[model samples]
Every structure is written in structure tokens, then in C-alpha cells.
Target: MHTYLGTFIGVLMVLTLQRVKIGPWGGTGGHAWDEGGHGASAGGYTGVRRMSIGSSWCVSSMLFEYDDNGKRVKGTLQGERDNGIPEEELDFHGEVLTHMCGYHDNHLIRWLQFRSNRNRTFGPYGNLGEDKAGWTRFEVSMEHSGSIVGFCGRSGNFTDAIGVYVAVWNPERFYDSMRRQGVRVYRASPLRMDLRQIEEEKKKEEVERGRLQKEIKEGRERLLKLRLKLGVDVLQQYQEIVQQLERGREGKRQTIEELQVEHEQLERERGRLRKELDLKRLRESRLEVELNHMQTWWSKITHL
Candidate 1:
């Protein structure tokens, strides 16, 4: 009987893994960030309740607000701002975030799109990167009756990378799975660092340290040989010119994006106003006809 019901749950309804983790997809330029916790309890449904994103030409920042087993969890903003772009808030209300897809340049996330359980599509938010050929697309989603609960990634001045944690959302299945197997649901916590994961992380850190050391060694060797080639003042002047050019280019791009967002808002306002004007004209026509009818009745009474 137990085997039969387990099979039924697996085949017909939600087959949930303890944790179905996807990726930290994006650039390698920033500090690693984790807002990962999928509310991995078999007692209740858990999912992202809302989200906010700040973007311009690139994704600047993101945050997730989660409802984890009746408790509210608000995640910190994941990245720094590159522009003065306003943040866009997406209030899911009660709907679950089911799917996410985005594109990333080698250095930063460029575009983001989202779909909810209500069949609503949120964005193709940022523009495609200038080098369209170099961008890579990625997707993370909940399988079966599930929900995406958390996010993790790398980010610097902009959102450099992104990822998600998925959990089964069927409240009935949670207790049934636990009771049938006497199995403990897997839980992920930043506080709980296992030894194998720690060792792997240490190895990565060592490799990065070695790479930086090698680069420094090579730079020193080159410097020793070509130390006298350029005067310090001349080098400073060159660097200043490069910085100026970079700042100017970046400033211009941001200005254009700001104007575009503002213009779109204005267009929507204009459409709303036009509809209101049409409604007002119809009301006036109706009122004018009623006035004529009253005047005609008054003349008949006076003639009598």
C-alpha cells in the first residue's frame, strides 16, 4: 500500500527532491551572494511572495521577499547600482513565481524575464548587450507543483550573475512524504557548512590566490625591465584621459536609458487621458439631449 501511494505521488502529482538547485549563473567579477533557503519543511508551502529589480541597460540590483512556512523573510539587495534607474517592484500578491529566464554577457546579466503561475510575463527587462553574440541565456524553474524560493549569485556594481532554489509547494505532499518514509527533509543554511563543501571552497580560493600571485609576479618582472620607458607624469596623464573617456561613454548611455523609461511612462499616461476625454464627451452629449427634452416639456406646459 505504501509503495503504491508513493508511486502515485511520483507519477501523477508532485515528485519533489529535497533540494533541486540550479546555478550561480553570470560573471566572475563580483563577491558571491546567497539568499538561499527554500523553506524545506514538509509541513507547509513555501515560495517567493514578491520581488524587486533595479535595472537600466544592465540589471543593477535584485531582491526577493519570501513567505516561508507562514514566516516572512525579506532578502537583502544583491548588487550595487550602476545608474540612477528607479527600482521596479513586482508584487506577486498570492501568485507563485514559476519560471525565470535571462541572458548574461560574459561580465554581467543583461536581460531578465519572469513568468508566474497566473500565466503572466513580467519582463524582457534590460536591453541586449552590445556584443549580442557573446551573451548566454539561462533558465531556472520549478518542476511539478513547486515554487522558486530563493536566489544566489555573484554581483558587483551591477547584477553580475544569478541563480535560484526550488522547492515542492504541495502542502499535502509534505506531511505525507515525511510520515511515510520517516525521512527528514533536506535543509540548506548558510550557517551549516559541511566539510566537503568547505574543502572544495578552500581549493577554489587557493587556485584564485595562485592565479593572482602569478599575475603579480609577471607584472613585477615586466616592470623591472621597462621601468624607465615612461615618465610617471606621462603615465598619469594617459590614465586620466582613459578614465575621462570611459566616464563620458557610460554617462551618455545611462542618460539615454533614463529618457527612454520616462518616455514610456508618459505614453501610458497620455493613453489614459485620451480614454478619459472620450468618456467625458459621451457624458456631455447625453446631458445635452436631456436638457432639450426638459425645455420642450416646459414650452408645452406654458402653451397650455
Candidate 2:
């Protein structure tokens, strides 16, 4: 029951994804689309090809179709734009499209990808042209036998786009179709690389990456130390300011204490001055009274 439910969900997802605009052939909605570069006609592709931005060349491919068992059923298309990057001897600007489809295991479909290119001859690095209205040629071969069906390619980019598209139908029928289109279908072995050797090479790469990361970390540490040294200098300057402030406060406190002592001494001197002033006033009054009494007696004796 669970298996059936999962199958239903998968089919629903496929149906939903199919709604997106794609090629009339139900493959990548379009190719080489860059704002004004998106459109389609019933015939083969045309117009001047432009390279992806910033790249010395523009190359892209997509996987548009796959079988229920997860095998590709379409070919691959790659375009290279020349910006004088490759040596100036090779024809660098051209497009290649390859198609190969068959079956290997019950669930695995095998296909070969090939490309066709057309560009000017400039020794090694051919100048790229902006027009796609040029002649091109392609060749490919593959071999397999089983029940297969359909050819479609999904649209995407290097990081976001699918890889390639393929069509895995009956080889006999596909062969005839290719022959008519001037495409030759034949038996051939797919190119392969040694896995164990690749693993050893991967280990070596990991070790080198580790060493680089360690070096970066040490460099960052050195930078941090320099920043810390600057911070310490700033802190010392702040400490000096605080000490100066403390000394200023101490001096102010001493001046305040001295002023307080002088104020008390002035208050005592004022009290002494008031006592001396009262004593002088009393002596002057006594002398004035005695002088008045002597003058009156002398006048009476003179009269007698």
C-alpha cells in the first residue's frame, strides 16, 4: 500500500513539473536564453550565438527527459564562445550536440553524448561569432537492447541546470531515424576511469586542502595578535588619563582642606579685634569725665 502511495506521489510531481514552459518537444523550455535570446520556431535553431557572461566561452547542456527507472532519454548539447582565451590556433567557437540511447540493466539506460562544432580557423583560438546561422556537424554511437521509450531533456545550467537529455526507444526505430537525419548509430564502449586511483587522488587533494586551511588559520591568528596589541596600547592610554584625573582630584581636595584651616584662623583673629575695640572705648569715656570735673573746681576757686 505504501509503495502504491509513493508511486502516486511521484507521478503527481512529474505532472506538476511538466507544466513549466519548455521546448515544443517538451525538453528544455529553450536554449541559450539570455533576456532577448528566448524564443522558438518549428525548425532548427538559428540566430547569432552569444557566450555566457564573463566566461571566455559559453557552454551549457541540460537533461530534459528520464525514464521511470531514472535513465536519461535525450542527448547533450554544449556551446563554447570564444573570447581569445584558448590559444589562437584552434577553432574555439562552435557548438556540439550528441545523442545516444539504449539500455544496460533492467533499470539503467545507457547513452552516448557527442557534439558538432563550427567556427573560424585561427590556428588554435578561433574568434567567436555572434551568429548561430552557421553550418555545423556532429557524430555519435551507442549500443544496447531493451524496451525503452521517449526522448526529452530538462532545462538547467552548470550548477542549476540538468546535465543532458536522451531518448531511449527501440534501437531499430531510433537507428532508422538517425540515418534519415544523417546521424550514424552504431555499437561502441563508453569511456570510463579507474575508481581506486581516483580515490587515492582525492585523498591527496584533501590533505593539501587541510594544509591550506591551517595556513589561513595561522594568518588569521597573527592578524588577531596585531589587533590585540593595538587594543592594549589604547587601554594603556585610557589608564593614564584615569591616573591624571585621580591626581587632579587629590590636589583639589588638599586645596579645599587648606582653605578650611585658613577660614578658622581668620574667625579667631576677628574675635580678638572686637575685644580690643571695646576696651579702648571704655578708657576714652573715663578720661573725658575726669577732665570735665577738674575744670569746674578750678573756676570756683578763682571766683573765691
Candidate 3:
């Protein structure tokens, strides 16, 4: 009977280990920014509660769920900003949370805090201590003016400070949601950071790096092709302009030659006219002298 009982206990332990999820476990506590001055309440459930104060720019909501054993199994945090908070302000909010509650070590706590008021504070025990086991998975989403632009998820062992899986979407949304909302989204392969997992991650990283490098090289090649095409077009245009200039110069030269010919013809005509006028003047003077001689001869004959 004792052997049977021992066997049962061993089996039970194995089952428990299998059922328990391993990862950073923590909770957050705060007030809702839009709750009309009311502080955050868990609604009778034990988990993190995020809230905000002062303005709608800091509105947020969070939920945490635990199993019957009081172990945190799931958590969700959502932050919404509609008043156009600056990136620096967002970063400062995160920094303040880290400084005040050390949430970076365990993002679960950070998620709990999300975008609460600057004066709000949180801790793992204060929010999640009731749970027998800490959080095994975390999901976060942030929105701007009713547009869901950011999302993230993490799960795994916290021994190496890296989760088994991680994902991020539109991380730049917080910086300037008006311009950079939903522009950048990426997912990181689950990382355990164990010796084998690390090696696998390294291999994956190398492959990703190679892929990125190839893409960059291809982009550069495309750019070069475009530039070369543009250069060719520019050269063609320049050659056409030069040809037009040359044609204009040729036309001007032809016009100048024609003008010169016309000028020479005019000069020749002027010389001939001048010669005719001089001959006419000589003839008139001869006629005048003849007339005067005839008159004198008539006077002499009459006197005789």
C-alpha cells in the first residue's frame, strides 16, 4: 500500500509540473484615467489593475486572471491616447515606472502599469502576490484615437530575462501616432536563452541578418538602375538642347550671309546712280555755255 501511495504522489508531482506555466509572474495596481476620479478596482478578481488620472491622454485598462491555485496564468494591458502625447513623454512614463517599480525585469508588472498617471505606482506583490505562481503569459495593446496601432506578447522563463516568445506591432505608434502610426511591426522568435535555445537563436539571427543584407543589396541595385536610367535621360535631354542651339546658330549664320549679299547689291546700285548724276551735271553745264555764246553772236549780227 505504501509503495502504491508513493507512486501516486510521484505521478501527481509530474502532473503539477506539467500544468504549471513557467515565466515572470507579477501584477500592477493603479487607477483608471477615465473613471471619473475613481481608483482602479480588480472587480473582486485578484490581478493587476491599471488606471489613469488628470487627462484622457493617459487612459488605460488592464486585466489579470489566475487559476484556482492562485497562480497568475494570463494578463492583458491596453493603453489609449487621443490627445497626442509626445514620444518623450511616453518614454518618461516608462522610465518612471521602471525607476519606481522595476518593471523592466518583469514586463508583466510594466504591462499592469501600462499608461497610468505619472503619480501612480505598482509592484509585483501588491498586484499579484495573491497568486501562488506568477504570470506565464502577457499581452499588451495600445491605441491612439480609437485606432489599435500597437500590440505585444511575451511568454517563457525569466531566468535569462528573455521570454520564450515575444512579439511587437507598430512600436513607433507611441512616438507620433499621427505620422508614424502602424508603420513598423515585427516579431521575435521565442527565446529561452538556454544554451541550446541561444544557439538556435543565434542561427536564426544569422539567417535573418543575411536575408536583410540581401534585401539591402537588392534595394541598392534597384536604386542604381533607376539612377542610371535617370542619367541617361538627362544626357539625352542635354544632347537635344545642344543640337537645338547648334541649329539656331546655323540659322543665324545663314541669315547674316544673306544680309551681307543684300548689302553688297545695294552698295553697287548706289555707285551706279552716283555716276549717272555726275554725267547729267556735266551735260547741263555744256548746254549753259552754248546758250550764252549764241546770245552774244545774235547781238553782234544785229549791231552790224
Candidate 4:
């Protein structure tokens, strides 16, 4: 019964996830701390190609790399400008940004999550701070037939306010639109690492991963060989013990059989002696009767 219920629940979940069509739900919700910085925008014609995010506990900054037709356009930095902060990169490969969800305190965004056009989800950057109070949930998705063109937000210290610009798949007027108010340059935020640096770091990590995988495989092989040898030794020891027990049982059987044979012979000898004694007693009685008869005959002759 539980198995059937689980299967039904699984089917419902799949159906619910598949309900999303090829476009956005158009909510595009994000977070902001305070509104002292300039309202900024980041996006392009073909939409966001990649993003670099810097964060720790709260989102520190973000930079967008856009695709203008086939050309690359770097969007200006959005947020703080300090260096050495850890950053996360989102390379769409070819997918476009479609939706976002986040958690934030009254001061700044604590975490941010994104979903691409292909339904790929990325990140919950920052943290759900120790004090959960004053934290609020924000979510947004494109409503109609458009992908996200760019981001517009107030910045400084951290991203203060955030919003998405959604338009049709490929609007030629996107350049003019960005000129008016949008993300145009793909410049790196000093606090956030650039895409080139990130790519190099990823390459180094992959090499290290390959080395670690090889070591793990070798270790497993050695461990397996040791286990097999130990198993063989244990089996041989048990076999010797079984062999000893079998020999001991055979010796016991032989001793019991010999003792039984001796006991049967003694019992037969006792029976034979008893029969001989009875026959001797009967013979003595007959001899006595004959002697009496002879004596009587002699006495009668004398008298005559």
C-alpha cells in the first residue's frame, strides 16, 4: 500500500514540474537592503550569457556577461567593490535566465537562487543568517513570451534593490534599450572574480580531481586484494578444524565398537557355565537311585 502511494506522489510531482511552459511567469522578484545607490541595469539583446556572483553570509556583488547577437557585452558591476570575496559563476551554455527566488533580511539579501530557461537551478548563495527574524522570501518569474533581457537594481555595499528586465527572445532595439537604462559592459566587480579567472580556477580543480580519482581507485584495489587474502586464510583455518573433528569422531567410534564386542563375548560365556551346572546335578540324582536298588536286592538274598 505504501509503495502504491509513493508511486502516485512521484507522478504528481513530475506533472507539477512539467506544467511550466517555454516562457517565464514574469514575477522576477529579488531583494534590496536600502535605496541610497543609483538604480542600475544589466542585460543585453540575446539575454544573459553568464553571471559572476560574490557573496558571504549576504550577497556582496554581481556582474552580468551578456550576448548581443553573436558579440559579447559586459555589464557593469552591481554591488560592493572590495576584493578577496568568494564568487560563484553561472554559465548558461546557451540557456537564458527565466526565474529567481531569494531570502533576505531587512538590510541585505541573505541568499539568492536562479532557474534557467531549461529548468536548471543554481545557487542559494550567502546564508540564512543566524537571526531568522526580519527575513522575507522573494520569488519571481517571467509572465509571458519573453526571456530576461537584463537586471536593474540599486547598488552599493551590497545589491540594494534588484529586478529583472524581460523582453521577447531577440528584440533588435535591445541595444537602444540598454543605452537608455540597462547593463551594457561585462566589466568585473573588483570584489567579484572575472570569468577568465574563474575558468582557469575550474581547469585546475578538474586536474586535481583527476589525480584524486586515480588515487582512490588504487586504494580500493589494494583493499580488495587484502580482504580476499584474509578470507582465504580464514577458510583454510576452519577447514583444518573440521578435519580434526572428523578424525576424533572416527577414533571414538572405533573404541566404542571394540568395547561392545568384548561385552557380548563375556555374556555368552556366563550362559554356557550355567547350563553345564544344571546337567551335572541331574546325573547325580540318577546315580543315587540305582545304588538304593542294588542294596535292597542283596538284603533279600541273605534272608533266604
Candidate 5:
């Protein structure tokens, strides 16, 4: 009988696990809703509740139906919670029970949280301890009857926590609904990361980098050519300057030679002027002597 019941519980656990599809068994961060009843009515469920969402089964709330022998008979799943709620609600909210977080896909990305009374800070199946308030809850297992259900143990717990619970919604149904609503779900397997896409991306980046390097080399060559041309022009300008200086020096030498010739001609003219002055003086003296002799002869004749 124990074996049959254990088999039954195993089947139920498998079903619940399939419904919640978080990576393993771990609790997501919990969100405690406002007890004042704002977020509770947003989704048409009364009484604000806390929720935890993650990629593992630990954050999902599990539901079980048990037999009279305290054995689990059946199972159901809830959904995954989101981070949309404020941080103040994190401690009180428990793991969500929903199908949205199951199936390991993003189509149904919603999470689940426990729904209970205002002052009931305990989680699903009384897994809460006295000091476990205000913490995210994770449901490990559950033994259930018609009305009273108790979980095996709390997987995630917090000390001095205000409110917390374990909760989960069915993920398969939520994913179906999302598909009906035209939401696309990528089937990317977390187990197998695609290396092809990564390689393609690397190749593209390499091509682009190669192109950039080629452009840089071409630019450097062009700049070198321009510099060489500028140097050639500077050398030509220096040559022209040297030629002009040489011509200027030659002109100065020619002017100095012409000045020397003028000096010689002026000296010859000065010598000729001195000779003419001497001749004039000689003629004047001879005329004076002849006049004196003529006056003396005229006197003698008169005396006779």
C-alpha cells in the first residue's frame, strides 16, 4: 500500500513540476501586496497577496490532493510572479502557483503568489514558522486532504519576516493563452546555447574591424604623400631664393666697376684744365714786355 501511494505521489509531483518549469527548485524574490487592497483587485482576485517568480520550481506554489492515509493523490500548478509590484510587497508575498512560469518558455512569463486573509502571514499548507513572516516562500512538497492540507517543509524561509507563502500557477495553460493572443515564444533551449549565432556575430565584427584597419592604413599613406609633396615645394623655393641672391651679388659687382671707370675719366679732365691755365699765364707776360720796349724807343726819337 505504501508503495502504491508513493507511486501516486511521484506522478503528481511530476505533473506539478512540468506545470512550473522553473530551472530547479528555488524561490524567486517575494512581493507582498498592499493589505489596503489595491493590487489584490487588479487581477480580479480579492485580498492582496504576495508572489515570487523565477526560473526554478522553488518559487512556484504547488497544489496537491491527498488520500486518507496522508498520501498525495493528485496535483495542480499555478503561475510565476513578476517584478511589476513594488519592493515593499516582496517580503509578504509567497511563491506563485501558475502555469505561466512553467514550460521553460517566455510565452507565459507570469508568476504566482499565495492568496489568503489579511492577517494570515502563513504560506500555502501552513509552512510558515512563527518568525518566518515577511519572506518569499517556496513549497517543497504537500500532503493534502479535502479541506486541510499541509506541506512537507518550506524550502525558502526568512527570519522576522512579516508575510510570505508558496504559490504557483499552471504554465502550460498560460502559454497556450498567450499563443492565442499572438505572442511569440522563442524555443531557445537554455541547456544548449547556440554557438553558431555567436560565431556568425564574431565573423561580422571581424570583417568590420578589418575594413576599418584597411581604411586607416590608406589614410596614413595619403598623409605621407602629401607631406612629401610639401617638402619638395619647400626645397624648390630655397633654390629659387639662392639664385636670386647670386644675381643680386653680380649686379653689385658690375655697378662697382662702372663707378671706378667714372673716377678715372674725372681725373684726366682735371689734368687738362691745369695745362690750359699755364698757357694763358705765359701769353700775358710776353705781352707786358713788348709794350715796355715800344714806349722806350718812342721817347728816344722825341729827344733827338
Candidate 6:
């Protein structure tokens, strides 16, 4: 049994090799298979084949690969380098890309097909003149199969307008290069969030934010009030100090005036005392002269 299984596996490998040599399956979906055949004959793609879709306002390019049957197998949606797709529109682009490439069952012809059928889906806005256009370009391989199928171009008319520009690539080479560079790919299922739930959460957050803002404002107001009260107290204290200084200055002034009056009275008294002393000295001098004369006369009488 083991020998039989080995033989079968060997035969399958031979068939696969033979198929690779012959070329891939015929192209489908209206695109010609002749180019695809040539690529398969070359064993792999030599360069990049790019395709641009949509008008100037909402436009994109895709690098992609078709399976043996010419159906889009895998691709990469790329954004412009300079005027990149708006960050808000990234999720919308990603969703569309995921549906096209990740979900293998979906039929994706153009980027516009990826837009939601609901009314007023998001997209880019403004005049779609040639001057306002931006594009993203990538190469698709006709040789190998890939995980990406195609990308879609879309625009939104919402307040936050968005433009999607994508570039697609052959996933086989992309994965091989990543493997060579030791890049690991982790696969996870996409999570769907309800719009109502998102809106509710946003409302809750806004309420909390408002509460915090109010607290901050109240705190500032309280601080301002305290500062004003302190200012008033300081002004009152300053006024009291000025009043005390004024009172001190008036008392000093009155004391100086009293001292000046007393000084003047003392001066007058001193002048009167000095006049009395001069008169007394003059009387003493007269008495001394009279005594001298009397003595001289008495001496002469005694001699006679």
C-alpha cells in the first residue's frame, strides 16, 4: 500500500511539472489569455503589468494575477505616495480589498463595485479635474497565482472626504520575497463592529471628556477667586500700613514744633540773664573806684 501511495504522489508531481511547462490555464473574464500564456511559458513574470481604473477624483491601480482560468486570483491595492489615501478611508479600502482578495468567493470587476450599496457611502469629493488627480501604480504577474484578486476605486462625499488609490501585485513573488527576508505572516479573522455600538461608545467618551473639562474649569475658577481674595487682603494691609505711617509722621511733626517753641523761650530767658549780669558788673566797678579815692585821702591826713 505504501508503495502504491508513493507511486501516485510521484505521478501527481510529474503531472504538475508537466502543467507548469505547458503554461497556466486559459484566461477568463474577457481579458485575453494570450499574454497570460506567454508569461506562463517564461516560467514566471519578467516585469510588471499595471492597470489604472476610475476618474481623476477617485482612481486607483492594481497589480494582480489570474489563475489558470483567467479569474483574478490575488492582488495588492496601493495608495498614492505623495497624496496618499486619506487615513479615514483606509478602512474602507481595506474592507473592499479584503472582500476581493481575502474572500475568494466574491466577484470583483472594478473598484467601484466594492462600494457599499447603502445610501451615502463614504468617498472623495471636489472637482475631478485632471490636475487634482493622483494615482498609485503596481505590477501584476501573469505567471503565478496570488492571494490578491483586484482593487476598487472609490470616493466619499462626506465632511471628511476620502479618495482610494490602490496598486496590486502578484502575491506569489511578494510572499516569496517576504519569506526570504524572514517576514512572518499572521492570519486573523476580521472583526465586525456594529455602527450603533460605535456611536454609543463615542457618546460615552464625550460625556466623560465634558465632565473632566468642567472639573478643570471649576478648579481654575476657584483658584482665581482665591487670588482675588488674597489681593484684597494685601491691599487692606497696605492701606493700614500707610495710615500708621501717616499718624507717625504727624506725631513727629507736632513734637518738632513743640521743641522749637521751647527752644525760642529758652533763648529769650538767656538774653535777659545776660543783661542782668552786665549791670551788676558795672556797679561793682564803681564801688571799687570810690574805695580807692577814700584810702588815698585818709593816708594824707595821718601824715599831717
Using lDDT as the measure, the top candidate is 1
lDDT of 1 by residue, 40-128 (tens): 34322255666777767888788777755546678887776435644444343345566788898878999998887556677776786
Model 5 TM-score (2 dp): 0.31
Off by over 4 Å in 1: 1-17, 38-45, 81-94, 129-131, 169-304
Residues 1-304, candidate 6: write the lDDT tens digits: 4345323332332223111111111112222212212223222222112222332333332223333222233333333322433422212211222111111001111122222211223333222334312322112222122222222222122111111211113345645653564434322111111333356568989999999999999999999999999999999999999999999999999999999999999999999998998988888888889888889999999999
Candidates in descending TM-score order: 1, 4, 3, 6, 2, 5
lDDT of 2 by residue, 1-304 (tens): 4345334433332232111111212133334321111111101112112222112222232222223322222223323323543321211112212232211111111112222222121121122344433323232332221111222332333211212222222446545654665643322111111232356568989999999999999999999999999899999999999999999999999999999999989888888888888888888888888888888989989999
Q: Candidate 4 or 5, higher TM-score?
A: 4
* Model 2 stretches with alpha carbons more than 4 Å out: 1-212, 295-304
Candidate 5, residues 138-242, lDDT tens digits: the string is 222211200111122122221111211111133455456444645343222212122433565689899999999999999999999999999999999999999
Clashing residue pairs for model 1: none
Number of backbone collisions per candidate:
0, 36, 8, 18, 53, 20
Q: List residue ranges in candidate 5 displaced over 4 A.
A: 1-206, 282-304
Candidate 4, residue 261: lDDT: 92
Indicate the TM-score of model 2: 0.32
- TM-score, cand. 6 vs. native: 0.34
The TM-scores, one per candidate, come to 0.47, 0.32, 0.38, 0.39, 0.31, 0.34
Q: What lDDT would each prediction earn against the true structure?
A: 0.66, 0.35, 0.36, 0.56, 0.35, 0.36
The segments of candidate 6 whose C-alpha lies over 4 angstroms from its true place after superposition are 1-198, 297-304
Lowest lDDT 10-residue stretch of candidate 5: 35-44
TM-score between model 4 and native: 0.39
For TM-score, candidate 1 versus 2, the one ahead is: 1
